[model samples]
Target: MIYKSMLLVILLLPMIGSLVGWLIGRKSEKYRDKFNILLTAAELLIISLMFKRIGVEPVSLFIPDIMGTGLALKLDIFRYIFVWVTAFIWFLTTIYSTQYLIRYKNRNRYYAFFMLTLGSTIGIFLSENLINLFTFFEIMSFTSYLLVIHDEDEYAHDAGKSYISMAIIGGLVLLMGLFLMYDYLGTVDISVLSHSMKNIGSIKYLISTLLIIGFGVKASIVPLHVWLPKAHPAAPTPASAVLSGILVKTGIFGIIIVVGVIMNGDIPLSTAVIILGFINMLLGGFLAIFQRNVKRILAYSSMSQVGYIMVGLGLIGLLKDHNAIAVYATLYHIFNHALFKVLLFLCAGIIYMILHELSINAIRGFGKHKNVLKVLFLIGLFAIIGMPGFNGFISKTLLHEALSEAHHMYKTRWFDVAELVFTISSSFTVAYLLKIFITVFMEESEEYRGQYRDHLKKRAIVPMIMLSVVIIFIGLRPNVILKVLEGTMELFHAHGSIEPHFYDIKNIKSSIITIGYGCIIYFGFIRSYLRRRENGRPIYFNPSLRWLSLERHIYIPVGRFLYRSSSVVFKVIDRGIINLVIYLSNSLKSLSGIKVKRPTRVIADLKIKKPKELTRFKIKEEHEDITKRLSKRSMHKEFVTFMDMVTVLRRNLNSLMYAVFILAVMIIVVLGVLVF
Candidate 1:
């Protein structure tokens, strides 16, 4: 009972504190900052207090007659992992934001949303009911949207548009899936649904797919990931840290529920996730290589690292009873990623705080004399690249082993292909991190020498230093987290024990080979083709600017086409029906022996004439006048007025219409499948 009450407090504190902090800031900003730090520290303390309860029975709270089916919250070992990490990272980033946001406008608004997002995210992890989970998921989306647009510039607004549009679409799709599941299975409780899912037939696949896609949007899966690169760079650095490090995991959390708990290791579904995992891995890394912006690169890196986690998840399904290693690897990577990615973003924040720039070309050599910053950045880089002595190496090595196990068991050519992609993706991770480090730290620039030396403060550096220590500590002692991961496997009904030799000869060699591939790619491809000399300094360029964008070329154009096509179809149908009705009325009057009057002007206009006749007779005079007007005036001015109207309507209504169109199409497809 005490644990359950604490659970409610943990969920509500940050939300309540958000209001209190905002009110306090209205009086004094200093005390508000302190209050936020204390609030988050308390959250972390509460989660840590529950650590001793792992491997025991789970804690749950049920509130009936709320949100339709009521709200259900649970805290098992698996959930505890996420809850603890969310609290920890939020605590650190809140501390970091204090110094980082000092010079920025709207500090009160920023901190309010920051803490609100924290509560919402923690609520997502604690949710035992799908509806409850979605409620928190949406809250997190909206609260975080404010953080993304804090800058309120054109760029930030653009990013926020993409972020919110996709989020709303994803949320609606997720809700549809949940509605269907409840209708079919009679409950939305995750535990009950898990068992209920097994009794259903092939419809389960449809349900799971909808759920996966809904979650995948948040996960930043490819094609759905158009918003991430733009969003991370636009958000404040501290917000960026948590956004990349923690929020994407909410998507992953939902997917795990569907794949691991609901599906119970369904092999076919797992195979599909594996294929998409490799695609995300390769695509994210490839794009990261071409990026010149530091935050954009990190954003893509988040995508690629998530791919690794997804692969581990797929392996768990593939291995069935012997998925212990994959389970451990996935959870551990989640933890490790939160640590290092947050560390790297904080490092980026420091640089941004000092220079207000994130472009690699613009900020080259900014950290040359900043040894403390350099060391901290290196720790994060090495961890992410899976250097032998860091936390990332442990999880990554385990993931490699899981892949090997899958290959050995299946012995199929596709798994062999997946293994190659895995190795290349790992190499790409190394290439990009090295690109950032060497360009920003090692390279020499005359413009930034000895600039902003006094900007480094103890408050800013302390959080990163603490992160570095944790990374090193976990890297050295892999068992500390491994034990926790092992205890959570029962949540998935996974059997077997995880007992990999972390420092084995083969694993070390594999790491070295991946590192080697990265070095060659960096020196051979990136340093050569991606840059050029300008005034005796190397300037980097992104070739991908010319590449086709999913949002620009595919999604938007497709949307416009649909809207135009639908408008034309509806117009033709409306006119054809009117003409048919007029003809029928005249024929009925003649048949009844009444005097048949000449056709009315409205009937003649509505008459369905041949295309050329209609054009020649009806539009001929208008066409002639239009041509004369065009000849008398400049073409640009004549067209600009019409185009401006279209552009305004599209700019204002495109996102909402696109979302509605997608929802409509999804419903049509589902209905067609069901009817057929």
Candidate 2:
């Protein structure tokens, strides 16, 4: 019963906070701060209860009768993992937001949207069916779109528009996939279909593809990730924290549910996911190395980190051996990614608020402004790079273990390529993160010093402190993350037999060697390659550099061709449209002026030879109408005179009476009030 109540509270708490925030936040600006505190306390308490109940007992709750739609909410172990990550980050962001959003206007509106997005995110986590998940996913997408475009700048608006367009398409594709899935399987419940014992056709592969592409757009996979860097940087700090830290995880959550729960461990589909993850891992890392902006680099890094999570999911789904370890590592990395990613984004926000600088080069010596923040930033960086004794190292090691186990089992060339690619990607991550650490912290000069001296604040330290402690705690004792994830992975029971040799220590040692080689490549090849000056100075490439040759070669010709083509097309279409509109207007005028009767024939019949005679004839016609009316009765004579006195009113009354009679007869006939 307590667990049931907790589910209700979890669903309703954000909505209540949203209402309370709107009701009171606008009248007093200070009320916005109060709303944050109040809502955070309430939310934290509810989430604490949920964790306690679920962590201790691990119960599942279902309500099948919702709105008579056969919908249900589940609090299973898998959902709980997402719930924990979202809840912890949301709490920290709330504390951070209380101080962060104070300087901005329209505090009330911002908080309201913030609360709405929280509710939507919680809905996504709690949804038990694909339809419900898609519904909540869209809500998460659009509500966050508002937050992204909140600054009302041209860049923000353009980014917001692109985000919505891509998100809507992704949602529609996901819906199509869900419909096809339900049509084939006859159910949308994730748990039911996973164990349903049905023969799936080729459409299953199509479903997997659609779902991956649908979710990959938000997960920031290559080619589909164009909007992420633009959207994250345009949004406010807290929103960016959740967007990077939690929102993208929803896509991973969706993939896991579809593949892990619905497909019942389809290895072929799993192989495809693994390949996509491989691509994401490499492309995300490669692109991140080229970025110069601080948040943009982190944004790209997010794509890469999510790539790691995808790797774990893909491998878990693929390998028959060590499947449990794969899922455990996936979920563990998911939590760690959220914790450290948000820490860095929030810390960057703090720096921005203080220095108002976003470029890495612009904040050359930000380390001098606040020593504590500098340390926190370094810790967050280390966490991301998988430095020893950080949370990232543990999960990454498990991922490598899983990949190694899968490689030996498959022994295919593709597996070898994936292993090599994964190792190389990890090496690049080390090089780029070291570059970030050095550029931000160690490199300093008179020009780089004291650029951000005025923006330091105690309020910014709260979230950093909380996140730093959590990262340290998890890093030192990774068993905490692994144990929780282990509890979650037991639900997916693989049926294949496994040999003890699959888990051999020799293979583990071999993978570690690859990792060592990766590190050496980072230090030896990439580090030296990047550090050496091209022309007696360190080198950087401009984004516009690729256009130089094109500018000299093809730009003028392409521009002239485009101009000529557009001019031709516009002229032709413009003439046709103009002619069409003119013809239409002339036809309307002619129709309006047209008369059925011939006025000349009437005048000839009247035989009016002169102007005075024509006037006399007009008077006679009117008198004739009066005489005909008077011939009916003495009362008719009085009515004719009254009509003559108010001619316009008489005409209007006759038209209105005719309309009313028609309407009355139609209504009566329909209702049988009067018979024909």
| Candidate 1 lDDT tens digits, 475-536 | 99999998877778787788878777888888888888999999999999999999899997
Please identify model 1 stretches exceeding 4 Å from their true place.
570-676
Best model per TM-score = 1
Off by over 4 Å in 2: 56-70, 447-454, 494-539, 543-676
Residue 133 error, candidate 1, Å: 0.8
Q: In model 2, how many backbone clashes occur?
A: 1
lDDT per residue for candidate 2 within 152-268, as digits (tens), equals 889889879768866875776676677788888787776676665246877777776677667777787665676787888888888899999999998888888777777766788
- How many Å off is the CA of 409 in candidate 2? 1.6
Estimated TM-score for each candidate: 0.87, 0.76
